[model samples]
Target: MRNPKKYCEIWKLQKSFPSPKGPAIVVKDFDLFLRDGEFVSLIGHSGCGKSTVLSILAGLTTKTAGSIILADKEVRGAGPDRGVVFQAPCLLPWMSAFDNVMIGVDQVFPSAPRAQRRQIAEHYLELVGLADSVHKMPAELSQGMRQRVGIARAFALSPKMLLLDEPFGMLDSLTRLELQQVLLEVWRERKITALMVTHDVDEALFLSDRIAMMTSGPGANVGDILEVPFARPRDRKAVLEHPDYYRLREHLIGFLEGQDHRKPKPVAAEEPLAISAAVLSPA
Candidate 1:
């Protein structure tokens, strides 16, 4: 879509982290822009630093080089303006689902009254189809259910941008598909700018407006940004039936397969609020 006010930008980005053997793992030049209300996916081999990029965006990790700009403003540190949903759900095992989501809302709006925070948290939980599970603790919920909480927490804050790092990777095939649909519905309803890191080609095609393909390893950089021209309210089965679907899918598959044959790379290394109190705090 056309550029708008809520867009997120990553300019000439580069990063490095301490490797087991020596200095930090080096990530070469990278750059991209996330338009307001756009859904984009970052897809690449395991060592391509996708998660590292997410960390930088989250302000949990510092970049050795480059800059992140959100809505025409340079991003210097973490704040409620951006929300992140991780792969593991990262919930507190002892806290109930409502409390878990409440934590994030709290950070973003610390001064808001308790009742307001509770309402926001519950609303997001309901949006993610987890109204009944609000009282259940993380330990009591299934993996998929736990992930729903993570999604609920992120969207509850109404941040200008949402970052998802393979949040559905741990779920079964069917559950993953269900969550995918849930996420799409939420995005359509909210129209929040979203960036997701995923290895699943089908998932990327299903969820993203554009897919950024990255190089294989060690010094991974953005290789291509392919736009998904499929019509809005996309049909999974019908899209698959379309001749272009396979072509797009194959192109992504070929890039990933080529990365699989590349030399190995070094390893890399690495929240929130209660109701109003949670959303505005440091992660």
Candidate 2:
């Protein structure tokens, strides 16, 4: 009856790193699809190539094989359509928070007037509760504040997708939760598609529409995809109270533990492993 809408698709994605010993495959046959305005999280053990997948999707790192299609266009390299925030804030030490954000807005909206760009930057900074710190440099801001600036900068670009690689991994638990709330608020308002790579199960459950569990690497792919059944805008307390929350949390933890026990496969100089259609299903 109705045609399925595909906002972003990753087909048979693969990535590898060369070494004297052999070519180590970091990601193999990673396949995923995101509908418009959906938020997904990738969770796996450390070094499972979770970040590699995000980098490939962001066009920051080239995939050795496969393709990434966004809005029906093949991703070639870093483009304005995708915005990234990494573990470290990675802000310029010399620039003020406002300036750092304005630079990105300027790049993405060059045709707009300077005044309009400034307004856009201010709007996002204010959205992230950084309006007062707009003039402060990265060194002057606390770790959490600096990360907020990074978030503001990314959002100001108005990208079609937001790629977060453990953006809150470096913060304290309290700060991490606070930033999560800020991110949730913005995401609810903008409804931008997002893919986050995180090791935090609670964070993933709290923020994602679906969680993609990656298998262990030298060649990792999505081993399972679990939908988050909680309704949003999600309240932390309420989500914890939901029966499915703990069930899903336990399931994810169990999956990670299982991966820990599996013997890692040796690196091979051949094509990486391919993900099966069944494993990629969002059900």
TM-score per candidate:
0.87, 0.94
The CA lDDT at 250 in model 1 is 89
Residue range 1-283, candidate 1, lDDT tens digits: 4358337878767676565755454455667888778999999977678988888898888888888888878888787788889999999888899999888899988999999999999988998999888899899899998999999988988998899999898999999999998888777779888989999999999888999887754555677778887877777787778778888998899878876775564344320011112111221
Which has the greatest TM-score? 2
Question: How high is the lDDT of residue 74 in model 1?
Answer: 87
lDDT string for model 2 (208-258, tens) is 999999988877889888999999999999999998888999999998998
Q: Candidate 1 overall Cα lDDT vs. reference? A: 0.81
TM-score (C-alpha, index-matched) for candidate 2: 0.94
Assess the local accuracy of residue 228 in candidate 1 as a C-alpha lDDT between 0 and 100. 85
Given candidate 2, what's the lDDT at residue 70? 88
Candidate 2 lDDT (Cα, 0 to 1): 0.88
